[model samples]
Target chain A: DVKVTQSSRYLVKRTGEKVFLECVQDMDHENMFWYRQDPGLGLRLIYFSYDVKMKEKGDIPEGYSVSREKKERFSLILESASTNQTSMYLCASIPSGLVTTYIYFGEGSWLTVV
Target chain B: AQSVAQPEDQVNVAEGNPLTVKCTYSVSGNPYLFWYVQYPNRGLQFLLKYITGDNLVKGSYGFEAEFNKSQTSFHLKKPSALVSDSALYFCAVRPQSGGYNKLIFGAGTRLAVHP
Candidate 1:
């Protein structure tokens, strides 16, 4: 079974603080993603990494950045955390060249920016 | 770009009754449709997906979804609702072409199974 683990499950930070949400996958998938979940907005992609050192912006990427220094780990960084950034963040991973694409997700990190 | 629409924001059903969550999709080419369920404070779990061949796809937790090409819909269904089945359900789609692996998701539907 594939396992995606998030470093933190809950966090609280003051406004304008730097925050980091880390994720690791045991499957060695080539693609990793970060998403934020909000009521009525569902899950919106924040950033994705296809390979080490390669990143792409998703639907909503403002105030957020990502790092993929290694194949097994992906980190989401908030340059300046704001109250609006408070939400549940999810990390997902998928292997390349699969006939049927399926992305596995971690438990998620709930960030509270006060 | 691929997109999905879950028409209902919420669906209330009684335990033991059949439940259905509606979903529709739009894509430039043939689509790969998927249904996922998210429990409170947890990430989304894969329920099922429709690639090709069978129109009716059965998935985990006794759940299923039907793919209708004409209607451009892939609605998730369950034979009987359980109290534990209540969760947030999301429908997603990706275009078969363009080597696109990113999935566009719906706003999600909250399923409430009353006892």
Candidate 2:
């Protein structure tokens, strides 16, 4: 069984604050992704890392950055958190070289920017 | 550009009744379609996927999806509905070209099962 863990389940921050959401996957998958879930918007990708030190922007990457210093850990960073950034963030991973494999996701971190 | 569309915003069904969630997609090349379910305050969980071969693909928790190439649809179905099956469902698509590894998701449909 693959396990994807999010460091924080809930967070609250004031406007213009810097926020970090951490994720770790035990499967050592090569593809890791960050997504935000909002009501009526579903889940939109923020950023994804295909390998260590490699990152790519997703559909909605504005105001957000990601770090993949290690293979097992991926972090999502909000340069300046705003109320619009308040939403549930999810981390996902899939093993490399498998085109048909589905992504495994963490429980998700709920961020509240006030 | 790949995209997925879930037509229904909500679906209500009674326990032991059949349930269906509609989804359609568009992509440049061959498309890999997937269905995911999310409980309240949780991340999306993979339910089923359609890559190739076998238009009807069975998946976890007695869920299945049928891929209709002519219609460009992959609609999820269940024989019988359970109260526990109620959740937010999302349909996603990823192009097989170059293994892009990016999944485009739909707005999602909320399933409500009444006992």
Error of 1 at A22 (Å): 0.1
lDDT score, residue A35, model 2?
90
Model 2 regions lying over 4 Å from their true place = none
Q: Which residue runs of candidate 1 sit more than 4 Å off their true CA positions? A: B99-101
Q: Give the Å error, residue A23, model 2.
A: 0.4
Instruction: Count residue pairs with overlapping backbones in model 2.
Output: 0
Query: Model 1: how far is B21 from its true place, Å?
Result: 0.0
Q: Which lDDT tens digits does candidate 1 get at residues A40-96? A: 888899999999999999989999999999999999999999999999999999988
Inter-residue clash pairs, candidate 1: none
Q: Native-contact recovery for every candidate?
A: 0.65, 0.72
Tens digits of lDDT, candidate 1, B10-113: 99999999999999988877888989999998899999999999999999999999999999999999999999999999998877764433688899999999
Per model, state how many residue pairs clash: 0, 0
Write the residue-wise lDDT of candidate 2 on A7-52 in tens digits.
8999999999999999999998999999988888888988999999
